[model samples]
Target chain A: MSRTRVLVVGAVLVIFFVAGGILIYVNGHQGGQNLTFNVTVTGATTMKPDTLPAHQNDTVTVNITSDTDGEVHLHEYDIAFDTRAGQMVSHTFKADKTCSCDIEWESTGHPLGTLVVSP
Target chain B: MTLAAQILLHGFGPRYDLPIATALYLYAAGGVVFISFVLVVLFAGDRVGPNATEYPRRAVSWLVPIARSPWPRIVGGTVGLIGFLTVVVAGFFGSTNAFYNPAEYVVWIYFWALMVILSGLLGNLWYLFSPWTAIYDALARVVRIEPVWKLPDVGVWPATAAYFSFACLELTTGMANRPAIVAIAAIVYTVITLAGMFLFGREEWLEHCEAFTILFGIVARFGPLETDRDEGGKISAVYVRPWGVGLLKPAPSGWDRVLFVILMLSTLAFDGISATPAWQDFTVALKGYWLPLGAFGLFAVRTFGLILLTVAFLLIFITFMEAVIYLGQRKVDLKATVSSFALTLVPIALVYNAAHNFSYVVVSSQYLIPLLNDPLQKGWHLWPAVASFTPNFALAQASTVWYADIVLIVLGHVIAVFLSHLRAGERFRTAQRALLSQYPMLLLMVLYTMTSLWILAQPITRES
Candidate 1:
């Protein structure tokens, strides 16, 4: 192929990739199912999966049940609420943006898991 | 963190990591860059393109006023000095809260990310506005500080050391997040920089020991603007040119320079890796045992890991260079190959920096105004009323970051391939031999592209 044709082909490929990325993002956000993660902490030991993935605008429900009362803070989402012992704290929110933030216990600096929300 | 790593970990955009998007982007970007490179080698590999480094200058005389006058530097330097002082004061006396402190944003986002970005885009604005340089310039005018002592013969090695050392501190200690530490570090750095200035002439110290100068100087080659000094010691015309043309010039021909470029990529690579779930798990598991060495032990382990990674990268790069030598059947030493190909890697580092931090800077920059209004948290609201104002994170969506990253990374690799192709063609005197040499480099570029995409695809601070 000529250099000019080759260059033109390269440009088209770029546009294709860009459009593909946008399409995935849009599809991820358009009315996805409500995703829930069941997290249980027993005396500082994690007995649950560490990462839960959700789409942007999808309802992300983290049901935290602990033997000891502690607070969980989502770093990127910048939201935190208290949890009580023997009581399940279901913190449900809209998954916004692509973020993989470390969820931490405010009292002990123990990282619980990750909230992976993507657009 | 060294500013780079922190921005990567705290990357703004999307709520979750998009593994699918990451995979698609990587496959597409890598495929396009690789195919384009092979085609270019086949069709146009024999000769230099129109934008070759030796091309004639097209004069735009209107830039004469700005280029001739030193006012831009003087004004910029003055503003930089004042701003530096504010950050220092804010770090020392401002609120302990990092979010409320202007110094945090100033140090990490503005000076760290923006400076590196601007250098790649606008040709080393640091030279015109470095607070350290401005201070030394003022002192030199009165003191007549000559290069009295014999300066170190090391070229860019000192900068590499300084960059890594600073990286260690940033990663281990909460320097970027803590106002007090940032302030103290700034003071210590200023004193040492000034002392180095007095020992060796200001120009010599800046050229040698200063990390930002050496870094910005290299990346400026890939930028659109090319500024040089005339024999009269006056800043020459702001030569406007196409991107990547400056990379063609045969400057920085030394082993130290090659090592410096390697270190730049290595440091950033480790930073990217350290953010991954696997690395985090290993570090966390190691930290328990390492803690016996005292409060500082875990940090030491992490820093050592960074050093080890850098060495690994160096080994891998050298092996590629050797492959190129063998493939082309050229009588060349490893050092010669390194010098010839070091400029090719500049685009990768530049794009990586942009892709890693662009969303974070664009989205998080909104915090600066509110922080600035009540910098010390003195509770005094400035008239700008930017306080209490928060930026909607939706502006820089996760999809946007992915798109920008894929485009830039693919483009950077293509440029790098083209650069190596041109240099190889020029050297071998035949396009066929040049193409033969580039097969090795092309492999390395594709690998590098895939590695970068993989890093971005992973979770930054996952609890593994």
Candidate 2:
């Protein structure tokens, strides 16, 4: 093959990866699954199951139980709830958008978890 | 299908939280961007844009007019040196909680992520604020001595290695989690920096060895204001260049610089990748395979993968560049083409970095508030009045993050396309040939753009 042809072919080769990525995107949509995630806050800085999967239209629920009295904020869904020691508080909403949002304890800047909502 | 294509598409599976919608749009928009770059290169002709307009002419006007005096240097440099020393000491002896230690926030969030973003936007403030440079300058001035040794002729290889090492330290290790390690790392880095400065003159060492110096300098090229010193050694006024126009003057040259450009992209690529579910899974899978080799084997395998990914980035870039050269019918030497066009990736790397670390910079940095209240985690309180201060992460909304992410990525990619077009125009004699030469490069940019966007949108999994 001519070098120009080879270069064109090589550029075309990249398209396969691009196409695969796009295919992944085009076929991927989230609005149907109902999911519940249990997030246990370990300390002032960490959380168990630090990430959870949700969809934009699904009834996604996050049940967070902490060892300390602090508020949990779900940033994308934009909700906050107060939690005392040893109680599992649940926040449920439409996943809204296929974007990731942080769930964190307000005071210590400790991440409670993340909600990876899909479209 | 290539192994990579299958891996990129299938590894995540349908259950994986890939940002399909975002990636799809990126693919389409990126194509449009590719065409736009082509048009700009072909028909737009030989316009070098506008000359840089100099600003207020009085940046150092407020500096108390201590021209060529050591007092200003001593005061500024000493404050920075004391701060660095304080962080090292605090790391060794302070609270074990990385969140409580000021060093974590100061180094990782403030210096690494936030300041990098600011430097890209507002120009090289970090060049002035660099702790090691300041300390070295003060020492050089006080000792009244020139550098004992000469600088190597190596083109930015030291900086590439330095930046890669810094990234590995941040990504592959838990330096932020461990204070003593942070202290040791800080000490080792300081020693190396000081020695290098002493050996190869302060300015030469910074330009060649300092990672942030190179990083902030590159990003500053895109910034509106630039500092220039004329032959008379007077403080030339800060000039406001047309957005990203300063990039046209100095493009990367030499093999080391080309590799530096590639490594710059790779390091950021690894940062984005390592944070994803896909990479976490890959590590988990590798852990099982490497378990027979024992505990250290796992670390060995992980490091191998890190190096492999970076090499893979190099391979992909050169392969594409080779194709571009072929398209241009070998008008430019391969190495020269690589150096000239590689600079176009700088803005993308900077923007991707900002997008990736947005949350960490915004929310995690909040821990600094309480840490500032008690830096040593002792009962010391410099600000007793602000003791009850609590950071609301909600202050940074999801829509806000999304806006910044998409906008910056798109803007940076467009700028990259423009930059490569401009550079190609400069390289190739004829504008038509230049436009034709960029077809492959533009395609490569689009591919990288989609990949970066997909990586950013990938769901954050638990760190393995």
**Which candidate has the top score in DockQ?**
1
Among the numbered candidates, top lDDT falls to 1
The stretch of ten residues in a row with the least summed lDDT in candidate 1 chain B is B1-10
Q: Report how far residue A4 has shifted in candidate 1, in Å.
A: 2.2
Question: B161-223, model 1: which lDDT tens digit per residue?
Answer: 787777665554434567788788788888988888788877788888888788878877787
TM-score of the A chain in model 2? 0.73
Q: Which pairs of residues have clashing backbones in candidate 2? A: A25-B20, A29-A119, A30-A119
**B441 Cα displacement, candidate 1 (Å):** 1.0
Task: Give candidate 2's error at residue B336 in angstroms.
Answer: 3.1
Measured with C-alpha atoms, the lDDT of residue B324 in candidate 2 is 68
Cα deviation at B301, candidate 1, in Å, is 1.9
How does chain B of model 1 score on TM-score?
0.90
**Decoy 1 TM-score against native:** 0.88
